[model samples]
Target: MYSSLLMILGALVVGYMIPVKHPSALLTIRRLSSWMLYLILFLMGYGLAFIDNLSQNIIQLFSQSAVLVSLLLTFNLSALYFVGRYLAMPAAEPIHKKAITSLRCLKNLRCLSRC
Candidate 1:
């Protein structure tokens, strides 16, 4: 277990050290990571489904999961709030809006009303 954890940390360090500059390579990495995460979650659910007395413990399991999610959200939000307050980040500029004229729509190949 310890060796496994050490190896995981080493991999993380190596991943951090390697810089991925290409957009296509980054996108491929992102897609692969997402699929891997989905597979892991599916396997976890599959394992849980085979556990004995799972039906009887469903409510307890849900409540525990809810509490855990709530705690994590609260902590994360509070931390972000404090850090943002300290940073005093500038507010985003409002987008400039223009009237959608028929001529503009013709040029853009999109018409809000009947073309």
Candidate 2:
């Protein structure tokens, strides 16, 4: 467990230290990381399937997970509701409907003509 934690932390530190300048490289890394996450989740489910009395324990797990999820949702929603209510945030226009700034419009027109 400690070794796993250390390796994960080391990789995280290395990731921060390395500079990825290319957009394509960043997209490739993101795709690979997502695949790795999916694989890990698949393997965990596979391992769980082989555990003894999992059928019996599954009910308990479901109930516990349901309760946990409900509590998390309730608390998060209530907090967000209270925050939104207390904070007098103005309703803003939708992004697509909002007027483009003169600088941005110039940049867009230049790019369209040149590129």
> Model 1: per-residue lDDT, tens digit, 1-115?
5986797689779988999999999999999988977996898799898989988999998999999999999999999999989988799998798677888888877464645
TM-score versus the correct structure, for each prediction = 0.57, 0.58
Instruction: List where candidate 1 sits over 4 angstroms from the true fold.
Output: 1-14, 90-115
**Candidate 1, number of clashes:** 0
Please report the TM-score between candidate 1 and the true structure.
0.57
Which portions of model 2 miss their true places by more than 4 Å? 1-21, 90-115
Q: Could you list the CA RMSD of all candidates, in the order they appear?
A: 8.0, 8.9
Per-candidate Cα lDDT values, in order, are 0.87, 0.87
Query: Best-fitting candidate, measured by TM-score?
Result: 2
Compared with the true structure, what per-residue lDDT tens digits does model 2 show for residues 1-115?
5987798789989999999999999999999989988997898789888989998999998999999999999999999999989985899867876555766767788645433
| Candidate 1 to native Cα RMSD, angstroms | 8.0
